[model samples]
Target: MKQAFLTALVCSTICSLGAPLKVKGLRTESATNPIGVSNSPRLSWQLDSEERGNFQRAYEILAATTQEKLDEEKADLWATKKQQGAAKLLVSWQGKPLKKGQKVHWKVRVWDKQDRPSGWSKIATFVVGEQAKLLKPGRISGFESSSEKLNQLYRQSIANLEKRLDAFTEGDVAALGDGSAVHRSARAFLYHFDSVPHLTEWLRLMDSEITKDNFFPIYPGAQTTAPVSSDSGVLVTHPLWWMSGDAQPTRSRWDAYEGHIIAREAQDTLLKGTKWGGIADSENVAAEFIDLCYLGFSCRLILELALPAVQPQKAIRFQVYASRIRKSFERQFVNKDGSLKSKSQTGHVLALRSAVLNPEQKAKVLADLIALVTKNGSKVGPIGAHFLPGVLSLTGNQDLALKSLTSLNAEEQKNYTESGIAEWLMTFVAGIDTIAPGFNQVIISPRIPSNDSLSWVRAYHDSPTGQISVYWKKLSPDSALKAEVMIPTGALSRVILPIRKNQKITESGNEIADAKGVEIIERKDGKVSLITQSGKYSFLIK
Candidate 1:
């Protein structure tokens, strides 16, 4: 009897310890703007955790939509673990790119290494907006912002974006789904083009179906095929949207153009000096122009990242990008109200992208572009519909950007809510604070700044590799304040400490990364410091 009792006790203890990790302390301190909101509607959660690590974890983040069968991999919509820390988890809910308005219930779940789940978190519902926020004398932030924390947050945040991109490249519906022309995704840019004939045919069809360059690209409302017996059509719960790769019947024709010269020959022969004019020669079509511009943008970045260039002739392609955008800018776009229909008109007056033009001309061209978008934006607006200007602008008030949106009627909001766009602007202002001294303020700690009873708590474990870090770039006009760094010890395998300056983070341990996962404390004395396992490196904040 004694031996049986001891065995039973041991079994019970092990089962309790090995139970699937539970998620508690569920509170949303802040809902930063959903990512790629204008193009891809999403929800972001900033929650403070009282629970520690469950060590090796797997998360199930999904959007509960009208559809019963929710396949994230098929849908192309995905969730990512973002803003990870010792005591907080910022899980962003990203819905797939969808047609006008689709409501969704998004939530997340975490699983331990043992494959048992702690259950899903609360679902936050939101609608996808066709247009992101346009400047309306309001500040814009988020892209390549200067805030150190925001930048660091990008490390975690972009992981999600990278995965999102890969979904499209890997031939998924979510990635292949596109709702417009002017707002083509990175996925659209890489649409299957193995042959020139196929590419040409596809572009022609795309021009009519969804190119913003042609006109308002979205389908007229009520034209979509709703699910049977349901008034509410299919909802976009995943990021990868409805993709059926059969759109291009002859996509294989472009394979012959692989020799570099074929692409060039097509550019010069079919397009140059004739009605089908080449990109550099000023007669380039808007679709072609955007395509080359994106290609060139990609090339520049790949070269910068030290990735080998597949086609060495990309340098020449760069020369063609300007002609595309410039010609489109100069062309008389079909206007809803006689507005210049080009990205330059939407903004982009100061792209330090190329050193080809003289400073005066470059500035003048950029200004002209901004002026076009700012002046006549009201006629054909919701700038994000066009993609360029709505995102690129960041400053004091988005008054101009807002104007570009052409106010949406209540009916329109049903399909095009600015919920995420509004938050993106908040992040936008924070970004400005990091660039210009008086641009805006960036809030570091208290990301979800709240006095609510909604917070949750969880358990944690210890590992040398598991760590956390919190960063802040002087957001206030004054110097750094006494910020408290909170880390959930349960999730950490190991802890390290270090400080970052001018975007450079330095670590301590030689054998191990000192406080690599540790947090930061930037004090008023112009010194920055952090606690590592062994010691702390302190520097006064300026």
Candidate 2:
């Protein structure tokens, strides 16, 4: 009896000392049991351990066509016996090439620092298909307008963006071209369609490449590497924070690098570019022009949104630096006639979109842009074209923006490998925009064309929280308008309706003042603006 007790105690102690780790958050290609995954998708998971100072020493993965096979340890598909490393993300599948629409069940286990093995993780299943590779539009987000040409343009733009998606690994997604512009444009497309999982994963991959000096590589996930002189991966953090409504990612990055380091790096880049007469070492005037705009814009964002909370002094310094760059931009690029010295469509568009230009200068630049487009059409390249429509609309020329949009020929539209068209259609034409990050607040002010070119517009965006949609029809030119809007739960919207001469606005046949879940903020600038909570609303103006 004494010997048995001693043996039992020893066994219990050994079991207790085993690694207290379990695998969780299993994902294939950054999605949980995602459908339409690649034939050879990458697997990833997180380790949960109650014990401190425990880290993964090695891992093993088992994949099979059926759960029973995995349960029985058959591993018909593939079995990575034990990969002796600490890689917990984007581990490639090696067993066999999965067929289209094939379902795969996978599980993983890991050994700890002391070589104590963890139990098997929960099984995750992914469906194999070619479609999984593309960043397609969400089911809840779509666009439709009276003009078929405009509708087709939106669809084609999405397709173009998808074609530009190049995977570094079997499951990793990155933009095809090098430079900040391509990746930034791709990210905007993903955000607009609410491709959260893909975007999050892509950002993670980009973040992993951020050097200790806070420099993001010009070409992510590529063998050839160089530091990006302009705002690339870092600048996209602002939109990601807003779209995800999660500040942790942004906060953590800044924390890792610290605000002062980031500010200093930016300042150095600016100084280096001063020699080249721009913010980056580019001989092309248009490239330099866009780089200057991006750098100044990124610095301004950091100064306003990121640094003040943690490093107030750094924020002040950043503001001064940004101000100097802005002044220098105008001095070097802007001609006496208010047109850019380069006389390129790209230069003008970048100038207009950037905060570097004041209102008067922007007006002059806008006039020049309109004239250039009017005379030559949209001669802007892929990068500059991304911001063209939005800039035009923000300058209060939505009509001109729409005209430029619909006038694009097939070949010209095909060259636009960015999300600009889709973004413009959703934000300007349908007029559904997020006032706060993650669609906690939105603005719905559809720019119904004053002319009869477009009779109606309908669109929706599935935000991280829920779906927000808007539809409007012109009952008659300058006579009556009908609009229907859906605000997701837990979100607020500010609706702006254009008030015609002596027109009265009513909701559900009742005065706007008496409508439920609606609050009249004001009537200003020939428009009625009202705030509303989550629900569907219909308005008529006659």
Candidate 3:
């Protein structure tokens, strides 16, 4: 009896040595510690203990949308009810759909091998940082100029963009799910082609789509389905891809004169003459011009967007090809008088964007194009409908860009057009241009457009460096513009804000009279420029 009692005591002591099972480390999908963007993110946790043989037999995970719910032990969002398994990685979330930017609070408890239940682990938290939508703008509220009405409109626009980008998926972009092949392709260029923060990933997505269509020449040859020239080096309009195979059968038969020409041949021919006509089956003259301009843009994209990010050796051959196409575009499209042969919006935009003209020529062309668009009373074509605003902004025509975006009524804001507005606001208006390869450096130059009513503007961008924000307010027409900028970590910036002659500039409420790491770069075209390191800066353009 005494031995039995001693044995029971010893067993009890040994049981006490087996510490309770506890979850020590927790992580979301892709091992994102605190920031996660996946809507249906998988959760994983490591069951830990000091005692030997204390393995996890089962686990119960609880996730809450709010910290309050989590603290109160209310798993209102998601709860894995006593899942019996050793699977600790990528445990799927069978719960309510996660909204963009939702913060999730989660904790887990486990049952040990001996069936002893452990207490809930410390409540860990993660923020849903990766939203499928455009980065949200910072809040701006005050009783100033047109606050209630304009603010509401801005919010609505942001909400719409969020919804649209959230729904935009890889499949949506690749298979022309959103529209026809041309439309989807244009949308891809507008949204993510050259300027997305994730440059490499964007290129991958674009390359996949282009490769799928066999990288058909811009113009398809006599054979509508078969390319008379399968060589990508040659520039042809593949009709099926161009118009979604909608051209009447008759047009295709007569336009076989210039069926397929190698890049070299096209370049030489274009340099000699201005007649860059399409095949018989091709679209109208203006449409053909637009198609050719897009072809040039595509080739330029290969150089500008894909070249630096890809292997240098792999890109060298394409680099040569792209340069020839650009030069050909310069020779074929633009007249000696800095006027486009097509005299269309697409022609003007592509000419300005391709940088094929000399400085004097560019200035003349910009003035003429501006006059053309303004004279046309904003009658932008389909291709122009997408790229015109961005081109205007790029050419230092912000007021016109604003007019292009806002002149369209609420009902007319479709066809991926608002993306241009967003781009202008976030990039040109806010003045956040990525200078380095991956936002390593930035040029933050905010300008007040001619729209006098826009007394204040605030914009944000999620660059590769991090979140960059710019806000500016014109206290009065004659008063200087007050601008605030938040530069992301690991980025240097050159800030250029509008200022009148003899006006002073202040950073963070202190006159930058003797600031270090800050110097006047130049005063050009009514804007004062300063180079600065990364930090939050507030400038009074007095």
Number of the top-ranking candidate, with lDDT as the measure: 2
* Ten contiguous residues with the weakest lDDT in model 2: 272-281
Q: Point out where model 1 deviates above 4 Å.
A: 1-265, 269-359, 369-384, 388-399, 402-542
| Model 2 ranges with Cα > 4 A deviation | 1-138, 163-169, 172-188, 191-194, 211-213, 223-230, 255-286, 307-313, 417-419
Best by TM-score: 2
Ten contiguous residues with the weakest lDDT in model 3: 241-250
Report clashes for each candidate as comma-separated counts: 77, 0, 13
lDDT, residue 109, candidate 1: 56
lDDT of 1 by residue, 1-542 (tens): 99999999999987656555544333221122221133343232222232323432455555555434233322235445432332233233344556556555455555554555565555454445543221111111122233333333333333333343345334342332333321232222211111111122223333333222222122222223111101000111000111111212112311221222223334434322212211221212243433333333332332221212233454355345444533443343323332333444322321324222335545554555556656655222222233332343432224454444334343332222211232232233221111111111112211211112112111111111121223323324333222222332232212121123433334332212343334554433322333322112222232
Query: 52-94 in candidate 3: lDDT tens per residue?
Result: 3345688898999887898898999888889887656557778
lDDT of 3 at 60: 91
The root-mean-square deviation over C-alpha atoms between each candidate and the true structure, in angstroms, is 16.9, 14.9, 15.9
Q: In candidate 1, what residue range of length 10 has the lowest lDDT sum?
A: 229-238
TM per model?
A: 0.31, 0.70, 0.56
- Give stretches of model 3 more than 4 Å off: 1-213, 216-285, 305-333, 355-361, 410-412, 415-419
RMSD of 3: 15.9
